[model samples]
Target: MAAKRILLLAGDFVEDYEIMVPFQMLTMVGHTVHAVSPGKAAGDQIATAIHDFEGHQTYTEKRGHNFTLNAAYADVKEADYDALLIPGGRAPEQLGTDASVLDLVRAFAAAGKPIAAVCHGPQLLAAAGVIAGRKISAYPACRAEVILAGADYATLPMDGAVTDGPFVTGPAWPAHPAWIAQFLTLLGTRIEP
Candidate 1:
C-alpha cells in the first residue's frame, strides 16, 4: 500500500505514549507522520506528561520526555495529509477550545479523512462538532462530552480500540496496538511480514 501522510496534533503536556509511540511506529512502517502544535515551529520542543494508573480513581501524571516538533502548525493544510491523529493528555483540554484547531478538525472531517484519536483526544472531535452520530471511545472522563456531542461513547477495555467508518478511537495509550492497527487499516496500509 502507498504510504500515508498523517498530521498529528500535539502540544505541551500531551500524553507521552500516545504521541511518541504512534509517531515512531507509523514512521517505522513507512508512513509520513508530521508532528505539529499551534504557536510552535519546526525544531521547537514540547514537554510531555506520563499518565499512569496506580490504582486510583484517575490516572496520575508526571513529567515526561520533551518531544520535538517536526512541522509547523501554521503551515499545515488538511488537503496535504491523508489522515489526522490527535493524542490525548492535558493538552486536549486547552487545545479543544482553540478556534483554529477546531476548524482544521472540521475540515478533515468534512473531507472524510481518516482520524485516529486517543483518550481525551476525542475532546477535540467533540469540540469540532464532527462526531455527531459516530461511536467513539475515549478516556472515561470524556464520556459525557462524547454523548453530549450526539455520538455514542464506546465502552471498551483499556487496551481496546474501535473503528467506525473513517474514525478510530481508544481509551488510552494501552490501546496503541489495537488503535494504530485499526488506523492503518483505515489508511489502507498493509504490513506484510
Candidate 2:
C-alpha cells in the first residue's frame, strides 16, 4: 500500500500517553504520523492528570514533539491523508475548538475520510459540526457534550476503543491499544514487525 498519512492533533497540557501512544502505534504499522499542535514550538510533554494506583502523580520528559506548522492546520488538504486521529486530553478541549482545527475536522469529514477521536477529542467533531447522530464514547466529563452534539454515548472498557462507521472513539488514555488497532484495521495497513 502507499504510505498511510495520518494527522495527530495536540495542544497544551495534553495527556502525554494519549499523544505519544497513537503516534507510536500508527508509525509502527508503517503509517506516516504527523503530530500537530497549536503551539509555535513542538509542545512540551505534560504530566498525566490522574494519579497512579499508588497515588503518585506521573510526569514526562519535556522533549519537544513535532509542531503543526509542518502541516499547518490551514493547509490540511483532505486528499493527502487516509485518516485523522485526535487523542484526548485537555488538548482537544483546548486545541480542538481553535478555528484552524475545527476547519480541518470539518474538511476531513466532508471529504469522507475516516476520523478517530478519543476522550475529549470528540469535542473537535462537535465543534466542527460533524458528530450529529453518531454513536461515540469519550471521557465521562464529555458525555453531556457528546449528547448535546446529537450523539449517543456509551461507556467502554478502559482498555477498549470503539469504531462507529468512519469515526472511532475511546473513553480514556488506557484505551490507546484499541484505538490504534481500530484505526490501522480501518486503514488496512499491517504493522511491520
Candidate 3:
C-alpha cells in the first residue's frame, strides 16, 4: 500500500502519551508522521508526562522524534495530507482558535479524508464547524461543546475509539491506542506495535 502522511498538531502543554502513542503506532506501521507546532519552526514543545506530573517532557527528548514544521497555521492546506490527527490537552484549545488552522481542518473534513481528534482535540472540530451531527467522544469537559456543535456525545468504556465517517474521536489518554487503531484502519494500514 502507499504511504500515508499524518499531520500532528502540537503545542506547549500537549498531553504526552496522547501524541506519542499515535505517532509511534502509525510510524511502526510504516506511515509517515509529521509533527508541527503553531509556530513556523522545527523545534520541541513541552508536553505533560503521563508518569511524571511534576515535570514537563520535551518532544524531541522524550520521544526522539524531531519535529519538522512542514506547514504552519498560515501555510497549511488540506490538499497536502492524507489524514489529520489532533491530540488533546491545552494544545487544541489554542490551536483550534487559529483562523488558518480551522480553515485547514474544514478543508480536510470537507474533502472526506480521515480526521481523528482525541480528548480536547474535538474542540477543534467543533470550532472548525466540522462536528455537527457526528458521533464523538472526548474528555468529559467537552460534552457540552461537542453537543453544541451538533455531535452526538456518548460515554464509552474510555479505552476504545469511535469513528464517524472521516471523523474519529476518543475519550482520553487511555484510549490513545484505540484512536490510532481506527485511524490506521481507515487509512488502509495495519495497526501493530
Candidate 4:
C-alpha cells in the first residue's frame, strides 16, 4: 500500500488519547503523519488533556502528556497531505474559531480528501461548514452543533464509528478501533496479516 501523507490538527489541551493514539497508530502503519498546531513550529510541545467518563454528567478532564509537533502550521498547504485528522478535545473548542484552521478544513473538504474526526473534532468540521448534509458522529455534547451545521448527527455507541463519503467520524477515543479502521479503508490502506 502506498503510504499517504496525513496532516493532523492539534492544539493546546487537546484530548490525550484522541491525538496521541491516532498519531502513533497512523505512523506505525507506515503512513507519514505530521502533527501540527497553529502558529507552532516543529518540536514545540502542546499540553494534552485526559478526558474520562466516570459516572459524571460530563467527562472529567485531567492534565495529560505534552505532544510535540512534527510539522509547522505556517508551512501547511492543503495539497501537501492526502488526508486530514482532527482529534477531539477542548482544543477543538478553541481551534474551531481560528479562521486559518477553518479555512484549512474547508480546503480539505473542497478537495474531497479523506477526513477523520473524533469527538469534539467534528466541531471544526461544523465551523468549517463542511459536514452539512453528511452523516456525522461526535461527542454527545456536540450533537446540537452537528445538527446546527446541517449534518445528520449519528447516534452511535461510544465504540462505534460512521463513514459518509470522504468523512469518517466517531464519538470519542474509545471508537478509535472503528474510526481509524474506516479511515484506513478510505485511504486504501491494506493491512495484510
* Tens digits of per-residue lDDT for model 2, 60-158: 234334322234544456678888888766667777558877887888888878899887788778778898888898877788889888998878866
lDDT of each: 0.96, 0.72, 0.77, 0.97
- Per-candidate TM-scores read 0.99, 0.81, 0.84, 0.99
Q: Model 3's lDDT to the true fold?
A: 0.77
Residue 70 CA displacement from its true place in model 2, Å: 6.0
**lDDT, candidate 1, 146-184, per-residue tens:** 999989999999999999988999999999999999999
Error of 1 at 146 (Å): 0.6
Rank the models by TM-score, top first: 4, 1, 3, 2
**Can you write out model 4's per-residue Cα lDDT over 1-193, one digit (the tens) per residue?**
9999999998999999999999999999999999999989999999999999999999999999999999999999999999999999999989987999999999999999999999999999999999999999999999999999999999999999999999999999999999999999999999998
**What are the clashing pairs of model 3?**
133-150
Candidate number with greatest lDDT: 4
Cα lDDT tens digits, model 3, 53-131, are 3354421223333233444544556677899999887778888778878888888888899998888899989999898
Candidate 4: stretches off by over 4 Å:
none
Candidate 4 residue pairs in backbone clash: none
lDDT of 2 at 188: 78
By lDDT, rank the candidates, best first: 4, 1, 3, 2
